[model samples]
Target chain A: MKPKIAIVSASGCRACETTMLDIHYGVSALNRWAEIQFWPFVLGSSMADLERIDHLDVCFFSGAIATGSDRAMAEMLRKKCDRLVAVGACAAYGGMPGLKNLKKPATAEAADRGDLPEELALPEQENRVRALDGVDGIDRVDAVVPGCPAPVNLVWAAVSALVCGGEADARITYAAARLPEEMVRPILSGLGPPPGAVFAGEKAVCATCSRKKEEKRFKAVKRPYQAYESTGRCLLEQGLICQGIATREGCGGLCTGVGVPCRGCYGKPPATFDPGAKMVSAISSTFETEKPAEIQKIADDFVDMTGCFYRYTLPAQCMLMKG
Target chain B: MTDYEPKIIAFLCNWCSYVAADAAGVSRFQQAANVRVIRVFCSGMVDPSYVLKAFSSGADAVLVAGCHPGDCHYISGNMKALRRSFLLANLLKEMGVDEGRFRLEWIAASESPRYAEVINEMSESVRQLGPMH
Candidate 1:
């Protein structure tokens, strides 16, 4: 049976338009034997039509939650939908506007710099923008396709997988692809040392790509406490802020290759440890540099770059957020 | 007001900027030798970081010389260089570096000597601005 897929998004029409366009194009390419309905933007229809629709196998939630109405609608969708997929970074990690959540508590001095654009300007609002994970019951989100606007290829693959009853395979594969093969092999083997356990020495995480493989299973590896080494060695080893520790192995290690550091979109996977937290801890452990000023500068620089994708995973509770 | 030298790094594309610089040299234009020219296969081959690196490495000014925008030998290498320069210039200003330190100029092989004149003029302008931190 062709699973009926319905996509529900927030009030913003511009992003919703782009999302629908990508999904429409993706679906057309897959030529899947499935029927899909979109709420707004490209569908040229109303949400009232959604009630008439039934038996949806996959439900997609796209766009950011900006207004009270959006929150209400999203909650309603969560209850009504079977399998909810978060589309776009906004839905997954809270997009550019989500960065507004990290604003420091108001100080009279800092508040004086409030000459930002209308949407960003303040007398800042009291409640920070909520990530999708902040919403209750939305936690069981099955899949996430990220990009300020989710990439068409990823969205297509996710949807196609759902259509083929390959959601489990896709979920594991998603994390597997993001992770290095060495890590994946042990993970599949159900062995010890666990994910994010900090293997000693610079072990390439994947063999197919670059991870170093061990002949025998290694256990109880001690965390290597190396300081920041600038020779472009693996980020984990240098204690120089590498996302390889926390980010899923897939990406074929993309960002690190291109020179932009990993922003941690993979976030903390459900298993061993949060990758972001581990990397942060590693960086903090090497703070024996003795120069407070230099350490502060490095901290600030690391935050700006690494924090790009931090809000998605760093929970509202981490001290790193206070920093 | 005074004769000054421009410490400029000219990233010339093999097809055009290289030719233009050669033309400038062959013409015996008698321009300042302050400019250090680096030949690249394509202007697009130049990364924006290279421009930033040049500034940090103490070049008073960075000039990217390429074929006219649409005339790149690799089909838009010059365009890519142009876009990159536009972005790098804005970024440099944001980083508190003097905005005028980065420049992008299009030159053809036949206009090689014109390259030397440009170097002398650009160097003089930057010398007036003093060292960029």
Candidate 2:
């Protein structure tokens, strides 16, 4: 029997839809075992069609819960589906829009000041904008596929595993499909599965990066906008704030591979609490300063510490924002 | 409210600051009885998460006391701690935590009076700021 699958987009940029479509040739293989019952982005399913559905085998819920309607839709889907998989980072860790948690919630008065259109003039429903995990009844999801837009191969592996009557192990599937044999040989050499092997690999991005790490100390940290020589050394060693040391591995060190620093979009290692806190600890330990005033001077070079540290996971992790 | 006692979590380095705190107690230095000290091997060993945890877990203020520069048991451990303090301070500011709520100071093993003085000053400042939210 074909498993009935439903795909829902909540409040994200529709990246998850792209991820699903990126499966490309693999979709033909998937179609043999499963039927996509409801996907508004692809199938143009209306709300009436969703309400008419009595049962669903699996539901891929993408995007963060950003409105009262989104919460209601999530609850409805949870009740109608046997299994619900949170797809993409927005659904799992709140993604980029989660940064808004740092600011005060929008008010009716602000909306009325000609800043927003008439349709958006009203205040958001109370407690509407939230991370998917923060929602009351749907906190415990069956599986989480975390990424800005989850890698296509990983998505294929996850959906395929589910269709094949097996649990989707993101770690095993991702490693098998993405990692080269040479890389896997050293990693599998007498080593247990890493600590946080859920959505991404256990080690930091630096583990996969090819940069040389000679000395960790730096007199001054450089912003990415400043010109510097990339002499096959670690970006952090060259005074750039490369977050590879604190970020979870996966994405195959895409940003760092192109000489750009990682912004820690993959969330934190499973062992850590807050990625921002881990980053603060990691970066601070490398500053070569003994004097109090000199430390402050070096720290001052990095403007907007919170924005840099909690760029992606602020809404989901920051203690102060957890009201 | 006038008699409200503030709770301060003090991370004291075992080599210098912890000894200084002990000396203050043994010498009967006049100090506020509000601080709860947690001894660490060195200031560098104190992760920023510990400080954030202290604040979130009902600490009215957090004091990180280390050895004077160039005097760490592990060479430059205190310096590393100093750098961490700077990063933590900015992070706290970004989080909208009051500036007076977190402090870092260096006190030698013999500076019992300085320890008492710093504690007293921190206590007064935090008392004025009231309890952490």
Candidate 3:
């Protein structure tokens, strides 16, 4: 029997769902082997229709859990879906929305201060935003496809896994047949990792990056706008503070493969709890300075350390609140 | 005279600060009784994660003590620790933690008195601020 699929988005920008669709060539192959039971983002489907469904073979759930309603939605999907895969950084680990936890949490009451209609009131937001798997009841995700929008290649891998049938480790006898030689890339032509894999890969992105590396020695770290012409060398070597050193490897080093520095859209490597801490250690070690006074000056370079480091994973930070 | 005592988590380097702390213990120095020390090989080995872990784990204050500048046994290990402390300090402050709660200091092997003083000072300041959570 064809696997039943559902692409659900909670409180996210809807980028992950669209990025999944960006696998244009795989659409035909996806349609052939899996039936999309629900995709409320582009398709016309109400919450009532979703409630009507008894079971889903695979549910690609995306978004941070920022409110009571989002939590409820996740619980509802968990009961119906056999495999609940977090499809983006937001769902896999607290993404950009989790940054709100760094400050005093905002309230939904702020929306009603403008004197709108009584029926237009917003749902109460939870005190802290969290990854789907981070929540208490929805504590287990079968697997996670990590990326901001979850680079389309990883999405292709997940879809093809379901279509191929069997477990996550199952071998695909034949990948998409319609795609030509040039169209099929290495990232798109793979099966998902075994279940319980928290990330896409074991190594950090720096291990896979193709950039030319040298003895890293920089006196100053530069922000993105302060960057000059690319040397085609390592971004960290150029003092640009690329997060590749701490970020989990996958997506084929997509951003760094080109010219752009990694923003750590994928969360910390599997071994790490905080990418910011790893980044701090990386920066401190690579920087070329023996003088203790110069070290203090280098530390002063970061204008917003929290935003620079914990821009994504603030909710799961060791300190949940400043008490 | 008071029952409340702040819990201070201190990471002391093996070569310098740890030795001073041990010496202070043997010398019968009147140090604050609130500190719990974790001896590391070098202060540089203390990751920023450890600092956050201390703060989140009910510590009223966290301290990273190492060899004085240029006095590291590993030669530059202390330098790396100093640099990480500055950055980690800013990170903690920005997260709304009191700056006084996290500190980095140079305590040479011979400066047992300084180790005693540093711990007591931090413990008093933390007591004024109350418990972390």
* TM-score of chain B in each prediction: 0.91, 0.97, 0.96
- Candidate numbers, best TM-score first, in rank order: 3, 2, 1
- By the lDDT metric, which is better: model 1 or model 2? 2
Summarize candidate 2's per-residue lDDT along A1-323 as a digit string, tens digits: 89999888888898886788777365565576689889888889987899999999888888888777778788888889877777777777777777766665465445546575656644244333566667887746766666778777656655654554443343466465464344334234423222212445667889888877898887787876773655878888888888888877767777887788888777776667677777888888888866778888988887777777776667676655565
Q: Residues B16-111, candidate 1: write the lDDT tens digits.
A: 989887777677778777789899998878766466557656677888888885688998767555544533444455445576677878888877
Clashes of 1: 21
Q: How many residue pairs clash in each candidate?
A: 21, 0, 0
Q: Judged by DockQ cut-offs, is candidate 2 incorrect, acceptable, medium or high?
A: medium
Model 2 earns a TM-score of: 0.88
Instruction: Give the clashing residue pairs of candidate 3, or none.
Output: none
Candidate 2 lDDT score at position A191: 36
Best by DockQ: 2
After superposing the true interface residues, what Cα RMSD does each candidate give?
A: 17.7, 1.3, 1.7
The candidate that wins on TM-score is 3
Superposed model 3: Cα runs more than 4 Å off: A24-26, A108-120, A166-193, A317-323
- List TM-scores for all candidates, in order: 0.47, 0.88, 0.88
